[model samples]
Target: MSDLPPENVQQYPRPPRIEPVPHLVVVRLGGETIAETTGAFRVLETHHAPSYYLPPEDVRARLDPVAGGSFCEWKGRARYFDVSAGGQRAPRAAWSYDAPSARFADLAGYLAFYAGLMEACFVGSERVIPQDGDFYGGWVTRNLTGRIKGARGTEHW
Candidate 1:
């Protein structure tokens, strides 16, 4: 639906590629801008949507540690965060890999949000679509192509 050329997720690397994102990224919730950054990083993997991790300093929302955590083979363990802003709360809507593997060291302190839990998430001036499923925190943009993972049949991907 966008004029921009589409990129297939199948073309992305397997072990996952971490790259700095110079474009502005923003997250809005409850009529407030909870996070905004031009210094974010993106993790692109085969069959998955791109996950944007924003610097801690760029997020305006208060984050509280959640009770449970998850593990990622490539990033190590991930801790969840409850995002609170403008008197609204979204529990465990964000996550961070405090001590990521050496390959993903840049994401150690950055937080990746679940776009479905927020009022809106943006990449540059374009609003993003949250990758389907509650577990994966990928942000879908117009530039991405191919069938994304995270749907029911994609559980094994």
Candidate 2:
């Protein structure tokens, strides 16, 4: 037998969905060609709707500035960032956690963009339709009122 220790074994959890799903797209200000992510990354994927989490290092830091903050019971406290482009600024369009809880630490310092604010947002070129209430920002297909509750379509967000 090999001398490798059992502790070195690495097993990846079966994701709800696999690659080539065409689930995410990145658009920068001034119609810039940003990175396009097709695969569902671990820290940002969800069954109902997948997400694209960009590390702070991947974003154009020159256009980003700490703007606000929020909290999540599951993920922990979050800090927000504003993107400035062409003299116009989108405040709190991105969010991250510098020190997330153990289970969520992989998301630390990684940025999640709110598609509702960007100039162009898409899931493989499929534009995001905004839901009712300007307070929340995500891909909105239809008026999901009674269909969704507590932000996640009933008991889940």
Candidate 3:
């Protein structure tokens, strides 16, 4: 019923894959008002690298505004935040890519943390930095064990 050539049809691109990067971030600050939590998040294994995403209502930790932010095509515009442990400030440790694309809007306002800057980071209680650099944020959870992976800029994964 068609007139086009068989090879003319192109397959649609695949969505970015988000594998779980198992890890835990423990917060121990001097302030009693702000609670300390361990292994309270999840990380994304993206094409560019890994990024940490924390459950909004699940995080017992308090966050303050940081100095910078940027835009993500798949996600959206983001805002950075600072974290405090024992009342000690860990600058720009949190970020939220608000107003993400329809497929990835779930990421909106969900905080992503950088393990390298936190007080302590553990991969299955092994004390490892999931990724090898400071540019990525490795997602984590309390009991989950695995690495997250996804392709950046691609809407479908």
Candidate 4:
């Protein structure tokens, strides 16, 4: 738990809100820093953990294009990236919506990582917890509260 006040994920907007994150975001894999950024964006949706998106220039590791992709109604088609560093590789560990919807245009060219696939992911001084489930890339920090989605019983949420 954190000393900060709790923020319920349920309070986030339905369509999701994309906003700039003032804190530092970092990602590590294979004992190497793959991505680090002081300027990043966060996607907050109701009952879901906030997904931090880092700018392309901020990523320090190599990102190789992966075959196949996914679709998001709000963010448009998504492409996957395989992160490689320090002789370690995490396939499809990152994703980006090159041409996002109008509401999420700011996310274009930005990348979001999966905490479970990386050695570590951080927001400020806090290490993040991967949202439950393999498909969702939500990041859970100490400041968040409420029953988050992505768990077994939350399939309908």
Q: 17-128, model 4: which lDDT tens digit per residue?
A: 9988888889999899888998899999999999999999999888999999999878899999999998999999999999999999999999999999999999888889
| TM-score of decoy 2 | 0.60
- Global CA lDDT of candidate 3, please? 0.50
Candidate 2: residue 72 lDDT (0-100): 64
Per-residue alpha-carbon lDDT of candidate 2 for residues 60-112, written as tens digits (9 for 90 to 100): 53346575677866568887778765455777777777887776666777666
| 2 or 4, greater by lDDT | 4
- Per-model lDDT: 0.91, 0.50, 0.50, 0.91
Q: Which model scores highest in lDDT?
A: 4
Q: Tell how far residue 43 is off in model 4, in angstroms.
A: 0.5
Candidate 4 TM-score, true structure as reference: 0.96
TM per prediction? 0.96, 0.60, 0.58, 0.96
| TM-score (C-alpha, index-matched) for candidate 3 | 0.58
Tens digits of per-residue lDDT for model 3, 18-63: 3343334343333432322332434233333335465566455668
For residue 17, model 2's alpha carbon misses the true position, in angstroms, by: 13
- In the order shown, the candidates' Cα RMSDs to the true structure are 1.2, 10.8, 11.8, 1.2
Off by over 4 Å in 4: 1-5
Cα displacement (Å) at residue 61, model 1: 0.6
How high is the lDDT of residue 58 in model 1?
Answer: 91
